[model samples]
Structure formats: C-alpha cells, structure tokens
Target: MMISDLPADLLDEILSRVPATSLIRLRSTCKQWYNLFKDQMFAEKHLRNVPKQLRVLTLKENRLFLPSVDLNFVPPSIEFSDELSLNNSNNSEEVHIDSAFHCDGLLLCTTRDELVVWNPCLGETMWIKHSEGSKRVKERKPMYALGYENNQSCRSYKILMFWDCDELYDGQVDGFKVYDFNSNAWRVVNYPNCFIMNSHGVNLKGNGYWNAYDDNYVDYILSFHFTGERFIRLCLPPPSQGCMYTSLSVVREELSVLRCVKGSSKIEMWVTTNKMDTSASELSWSKSFTMNFGFPVLVYTGLLIDEDKKVVLCNTIVGDHLRGACTIGEEDKYYSEIAFEGMSLSQPPHIFNYVPSLVRIQEGTELDVFGKSPRRRGDDPPTRRGDTAMCDHDFQFSQEIDDMMS
Candidate 1:
C-alpha cells in the first residue's frame, strides 16, 4: 500500500517521529500532511514523541549558520551546513537581527526596526511590534527574553522587554513590560531594583535567568518566573577569585555554569543538583570537572557539556587574538579545534544548543492565568562569593545551582 493510503492516525504516528527539518521540507508533497503538521494537537504529539537533535547555531551579520556536530570523535567534529535566511517573503529585503533569544524551540529576534518570534525549523515567523514605552526606550535597545507558562496542557508564551540599568538601578528604578502571545499586546510590570541584571540571559523550563550583582557587589543568579510574573533570586556556587568570564548553559535538562578565571588556564564547571525549585530556600551546586587549556581563556563564551563523554564544546580565543571553537576533555584526555568550512573565525559568534520542535506561537485573547503568588522573601543566610559573604537579600539570585547526575 502507498504511504498516503495509511490510516490518518497511523500516518500521524509515523510522521510525528520524523525530524522537524525533514518534515518541514516534506510538507509540500501532500496537502493532507501539510494540514496535519499545522494542527496544534499533532504539533504537541510531535514535540513529545520526536527525539531531539542538538545543533550549534552561529549568527554573523544577521546570517544564521547551522553547523552539524559529531561528538563521537576525540576532539569532536563540526561541519558547515547552511546559512539560514530569515526573510521568507517575496520581498528580497534582508533581515538584520541585532540579537536573538531562544526558548522552547522558538527564537525572539530583534532588528534595527522591529522584533519577531521565529521557528526556523518550520520556516515560521511572527512579528511583534513595540509598545509606546518600548519605543521611548528604543535608544537603549531594551534587552529581551522569550519564555512561556505551562498551565496544564496549554503553554502561554511571552516576551519580556526590559532595560539594563546597572549604573542607575539603585535609583530611578525602571519598570519592564511583557508581551503576551495570547493577547498580542504589551503591559507594564513592576520592577524590583534590588539587583542589577548582567550578561546574557538563558531560559530554563519556561523561566528566564541572568547573572546579576547587587549594590554590595555580590554576584548571583537572577530569575524571572513567567508563571508568577515575579522575580526570584537563586544562589550560585562559592565564588571564584579573579573570575574574568562566566556563562550559563542548560545541559542534559539541568542548568550549568562555566567560570573562566583571569590569567589562569583553569576553567571550572559547576552543575546544580536539583531541578528548578523556585520556592527552595537555597539552591545547591557541586563541582563537576575542570579544564586546563594551558592558556588563559580571557573572554565570556558559550558552552555545552557532554556529561557522559566528559567533554566540553565551546567557543575559544587562540593566541589572544583569533576566535575559534574547540572541545576540551578531562585531564588531557583530548583537546581539538573544530574547523568550520567557509565560515569566518574573525569575530566571535553567539553559540548555543538548539532543539527543533513543532510548538506553535498561539494568538488569542489573554487568559486570566497567574501562578501561585510570588513567594515571600525570608531572612536567608548570606551567600558566599569567594571569601566575601554577600548580604543575601530575598531577591538576589545565586550562582552554581545545577543538575548534576552524581
């Protein structure tokens, strides 16, 4: 029997297991399959049933380059794939993305004039216009984060637009706004000026996290809970002295932090021991492994760790000049440079782990959904950063909290 002759449910069961990239290309072959792939129910099934494939995405001059990675090799292997164009319309105008945020298989990208949420795997894009408040602060080019709230089987996605005011956070506190996909509108949200958000933000299980410091210069993890529409602070591992760079990544479904110390070749990896518990009094972190590259890694860079293989794939600087990507293994087990064909290493490109999904951005009236009201802050003990004991305010986020298998 022809594949098209299969029963409707049977066809969905088979197609749901196909990789997203393949499915996207094959959708044009059959009208029935095209409509089925667009069905929200089928998308959910595809998300739950299809195995995830992780790839490295690098953005250069608004161009997206996806490179295929092979971890079975010693130093690991990466090869150039394709340059993804964001412009899917008949107009030939190129899309220039200033920055991009990833959450739940969708990317929130900002350009010189507007913002858009994109599912590159499915070749889908949704434009989000700025609010009046956002336009007034356009010169600042407000930072953005994409996240969602899971209310039972439904997922409500939202975009957070806020300004980075570390220099003036103590005074003239600035408020932030949230753009609800369901409502297709923006609303201002209260901002807590107790801490200053720093560095790039990462999303974990529908929440947004960033490296932050307080007035006392204590560094911690700042988390914005979308479900609660409130900010909460989580603690980091004991601080490292002369730490020149810090970056966060989600590894094996848990949070991981990479600390690169100044003038030192030693890089330490810390993993959180528990899943994200927003209400926990303290988050725990344990040292995973360390990499000694024999040369100081002087800049902040993105990284992905293979827990079982004991290998780390990350962007690196060579000879204090050239930029490149490499894999670092434990105790001299291996170290090798990944060469990308036809891609420039002249500038450091943003790198992150990505899994394609069929999750669609829903549009409708906003639901009156709110999470358990913000947790009451208590007198938590001071969190230690190196030797300094930071006065742990209830809202100050922490570092080093991760998911470690053992």
Candidate 2:
C-alpha cells in the first residue's frame, strides 16, 4: 500500500488536503498520481485544497527574482517554486514590478512588457498582447488592472494574442473590451473615466464599476456600467463620499468599499462591507478587527485574505509582520521570517483570501468553481475581462451573461 496505490478518489481527497505549492512534485510518484493531478476535476479538487489564507507574493533578492505566492499555514508548507528564480544574468533588474493584483485565486503581475496573468500555484502563465511590444510597453504605463481572464484552462487561450492586440485601451476613454474565453476573441464598449486606484484592485460586480471619479471638481466614488455599450452610472455608496483614512477595493463577488468607520485609540483597523443589495449578493463583510500597527501615512501596498479565512494578508515595511495581528499593551506578534530584499514592486506582501462572492472550494459541485464559462458555442470573444467562458473552456460564440452564470 504505497502512496501511489491509493485509489483515485481517495488520492484526490488526500491531495486536496495538501497545499498547491508542493502538489506539482507529487506527480513524480507514479502515473496514477500524475493523471490524477492533471485531470481538470482532480486539479480543481487540489485547488480547493489550497487554503485561501495562504499568502502569495513576488520576491526580488540579490537579483534572484521570482513571482511567488505562498500558503504558509498548511502543514509541511514552505513551498515557493512555480515561480521564477532570477539572477544577475537575467538583466531584468531594470524591468521590475510595482504592485500585485490577486484576482480570484490567481495573481496579476505588471511587468516591463504587459499585464501578465500568472498562476504561481500551477506554474502556468500568459501575456496579453499589446501592439507596442515589450519595448514600447515601458512607455505606456497602465496604472489600474482587473484580471478578467486567464487562458491556462485551454489551448484557444493561445489565440488570445491575435485578438487582444487590436484593443489597445489608450485614447479610448470610458471604453472597455472583455475577453471572450469561449470564442477566443475581444469585444469593445464605450465607457467613462472613473477613478484610478493606484495601490490596489477595484471592487466589481455585474452592476457597476465602483471607482473614484471627479464629480464637479471633487473626487467622488462612482460606479459605472455599460448599458448598450454606453456608460451608465450606478448609485453612489454613502460612507465613501467623504473619507480620508479609508480604502476601496473589491471583495468576494460584490463591490466592497472599506473605510475606517470606527476604532479604539490603541487598536485601530478599518471596517469594509459590500454595497450590492439583491439576490446576486454572495457575502457581506461585517467583521472589524482593530489594528495597533503602522501609522496611517504608511503606504499600504495591497490587502487580500488567506484562502477564504477571516485573516487578511498584507505586505508592508520593516515594522510590519507576516500575519495580521493587533499589538495591544506591548504584547508581541507572530511573524514569518520570509525576507524580501528590495522594494522595486512596493515591499508590501500579498494575501489571497476568501472574498464576498468567493468561497474556498469544498463540498460544492464543480459548477460553482470553473476556469471556463457554462455558456454556449460559436461566437466572437468577449470584449471585456469578466465575460463568460464555455464548458471546459469550450467558449460559446455568443453566450449571454445571464445564461452563463445562472
């Protein structure tokens, strides 16, 4: 009864309990393990096993560069492969990343060339084709990004380069093009210039784009939607109207706008909640834990949860700790010794957690969690990122949004 002798179902169950960082090597155990690991269903199961509390990050030390994400909480957990191990000869120190956007369970890295969809968990990757090539990409700086699609699920994702090259979002103000995972194409729609969130990802939903925009000369938090390819604004959130010590980013599947609503003198942390009110809403953020760490002025690089847990993973300067905690009355905090040498991509660490509409893979059927859409066959690709994918990444030609999800 060796490890390979375990039945596929039982093996899958066992694999699901392991962290994603080390799952790759288990393939060498035997043909059975390799097939089980490669099967989409089995892979999905393993993904479910990856605890959301595991924090993934990009590390640049002594020219040994690697875009790494981690699930430090898992047993036997200190895995950091599937990431690039860089060196002086790489000559890439000049091309560095500044921020990280942990979309869904994946990470979006802004590189010298373009916005790349990176799966540090699986070691698979894809680069969105821009007309300027990698050289011109240095000049055209894209500040905000929301990774709507990743092609790792299928081969058509390869054709993504051909279609997306035409949709260079420059000078096309308020216009958006979603990527159709099924059709392997790109579609365009007109939009308005909303807010530009510099250090984090924005909140999202089927309804509106919750962003900061100038309303009559003042910064007003706004939500814009595409009605017939035209920009239509949604109702503004009340609390975000006038607040300084606050932050806005998407959580779960709804638009979560977090602000420092309340706090005690010694332990002060912010409170964030969702703005979606309807059947579509999945999770409502009602938890508020105060913080006794860094000053308010300290630049917050980004924030994410650990595999659907209450813990929020954050990356910051020297005084910051690996895990989230409150330092009250001089008591110490638990910190991981993961050292990131430089600050090319803002020294803040990355935490991937369970979001509002997001759930850690578990008892649910394979339907809720899929890399592809449930829509139909034969149509042009989506013009935006959040569009649907077809069954097993067999994208539909013209699958409507309602039919895809519902």
Candidate 3:
C-alpha cells in the first residue's frame, strides 16, 4: 500500500514522533503533511513525545548563548561557543536586544524601537512595533511579556505590552495592549493595576504574574490570564519592614517569593501552596527554607529550583563578579559555585528555565497575516553592527546595591 493510503490515525502517530526541526523541512513535501503537522492535536502529541531538559540562555557581546544544566552532576564552569546572532545587513540600522523572555520554545526580545519574537530552533523571527499611544508616553518604559493560552479547541500565543502614563494617578498606567499570534493584530486592554515592577514577568501554565505596587506602597501579585484576557490581583505575604530586596519567581509550578528579611543574615523563600483559590488568605505561603550565606555582605537572587534534587540555583554578588551557586537541602546546607571561563559577571544575566520545542509562533494563521512573506530556515535577513552599544536599561538590580556588595 502507498504511504498516502495509510490510515489517518496511523499516519498521525508516525509523524508525531518526528523532531520539530525536521518537520519544518518535511512540511513542504505536500499539503496534507503540512496541515497534519500544524494541527493542534498533532502539535500536542509531538510535544509530549519530545524530551524536556533545562537550559540557560544568556547574552554577551551582542549574541546569545545557551547551556544545558544537570543538577546531579554540576559543572565547574559552562562554556558556550554556539552564538545566536542577528543576521542583519551592513547598511540597515543594527537591532539591539535590551531584554528577553522565553515561553515554550519562542523568545520575546525587546529593542528600543520594536519587539522581536524569535524561535532559535526554527530560526524564525517576527517583529512588532509599539503602539502609537505608547510612543507618546515617554516617561515610563514599556513592559513586555510572552505567554500562551491553550484550551480544548485552540492554542494561542500572545505578547502583552503596557506602560505607565503620567495623565493617570501616580501608580496608574496606560497603553495596555495584547498581540494575538493567530490574528496578527494588536488589541488594547484595560490596565487593572497601578504599576508593574520593572522586571520580567514569570509565566506558569498559561498565566503570567508580576510584582506590582500602588501609590500607597502596598504590594500585590498582578496576574494576567491569557485565555480570559483579564487581570486578577493576588495578595503577597505581609511585607517585612527593612527588607533589602524581594523578587518573584516560579518554583516547581508554584508562585514563589524570595525576600531578604531586615536585621537578619537569612534569606527566606516562600512558595504558594494553593494558587487555584482566588482568596488572598486562601493563597498560603509555606516557608520552603532559609539560607544564611554565613556572610553579612552576601545577597542572592533566586533563579530556579530543582525540587527532585532539593537544590536551588541562585546568583550571588561577590566582590565585583556575579557567581552562580547551588543551594542544597536544608539538613546538608551545602553551596557550590558554578565555574565558567569567559563572559563578564559585572552584569547579572537574565536567566530562565527553558525547554526547547518545535512549537511555531504562526501555525494556524495564513502566511500573509503580517503582510510579509513566510520566512523559512536559511532565509535570514542580513544584520549590521550599530555604532552605539546597547545598555541594559531594564536591568532589575540597582547599581548602588552592586556597588555596596563590591
């Protein structure tokens, strides 16, 4: 029997096991295979068949480097030779990526002028321009986040952008918008909170959460549900007076906060045990553990947590360099440094737990949705280096703190 004559179910089962990179090339063979590969059911099944691994993406010298992590066997230092650089032309203006956030397999990189959604695996990119209202508001910088929503019938990826407007109250913000990949259009949305902290939003499942505060200095968790296109406010643990720094992260699928308590050398980590319930009191914060670096000057930012190994990955400022450390279980309380050969630690890199996949940003839409031809592998546009260097204006930490640690 011919391959095209095979049963539909059997064909789907066979194609689901194929790797995403290869599927990109195979889709051109025929219209039937192309549609099957882009089907929601086929994509879900293909994702399940792919292995999940943790990798770190960092930027240095105007390029991106990705390195794999294995908790069981820690490496002295990670060395990355593979660089993901922009392929622009020598004549065109160079693009500077100020900050980046990862969701599923795609990365949302922000430049001064535009937002670029890039897929390193598929070598594809889509550029988006900021709204006209946002461009008019020059006081506050724009906030960007990449997230996905999945239901029984559809799976959608979206980009959210918002900025504070001076016309509103002190904490109030304006120019909130969302871009749907399927529609290739931007829609204005209501801004529920007064202000969102200038940090990357942590995405869990299909929702994104950020640490936000109001004019009264009251802190709360600002959550955005992608599927519903609505915002929900969740309460934070009562603030501890004189805390040095507090940051939010996603640990083992739960919302977690790392706070350095006042008048103490200990750093406390609290994880939300119950997140589904909307009540502020119902959302419980269970103390995961306390870390005392045994040095009065030590401060850390929680990066990722390996629950299975009982180890937490963190970045600590020591002297003039930023170092990576693994904090072991409570009883043992062991900390080990991750060794690396190149790259300066002066700037703390934005780190995220990345799982590579074959997910496409524009699967269900037509090729001309953006009024541009579809980009395939090896069709990258030429990139040129700009005269001026790009600075990390959105770097979360303050220079004063780094100076104090140094």
lDDT per residue, candidate 2, 20-75, as tens digits?
A: 43454343344555445556555444544555333324343322122232334331
Per-model lDDT: 0.65, 0.35, 0.59
- How well does candidate 1 match the true structure in TM-score terms? 0.76
lDDT for each residue of candidate 3 in 143-176, tens digit (9 for 90 to 100): 6788877767656888887774454446466667
Q: What ranges in model 2 sit over 4 Å off?
A: 1-6, 56-95, 132-140, 143-173, 181-184, 192-195, 202-211, 214-242, 245-287, 292-298, 304-406
Clashes of 3: 9
Off by over 4 Å in 3: 1-37, 48-51, 59-62, 68-82, 89-95, 131-137, 164-173, 237-245, 275-282, 296-301, 317-334, 337-347, 364-406
lDDT per residue as tens, model 1, 1-406: 9997899889889998986655755554545665676677788788778886555566655667665556666656665445656773336466877677888678888866567778766556666556432333533437789998767767788888887543333522255888877666678888675666655688887888877777787878888888888887778888778664367777766778877777788888888888674565466898888888888774345666466766776777655454566777675745777643344543356666666776667733344223211111111222332212222210121110010100
- TM-score to true structure, per model: 0.76, 0.51, 0.70
Candidate 1 structure lDDT: 0.65
Q: Flag regions of model 1 displaced more than 4 Å.
A: 1-15, 68-81, 88-90, 131-139, 165-173, 240-245, 277-281, 317-323, 331-333, 337-348, 363-406
Q: Higher-TM-score candidate among 2 and 3?
A: 3
- Error in Å for residue 285 of model 2: 5.0
256 in model 3: Cα distance from truth in Å?
2.9
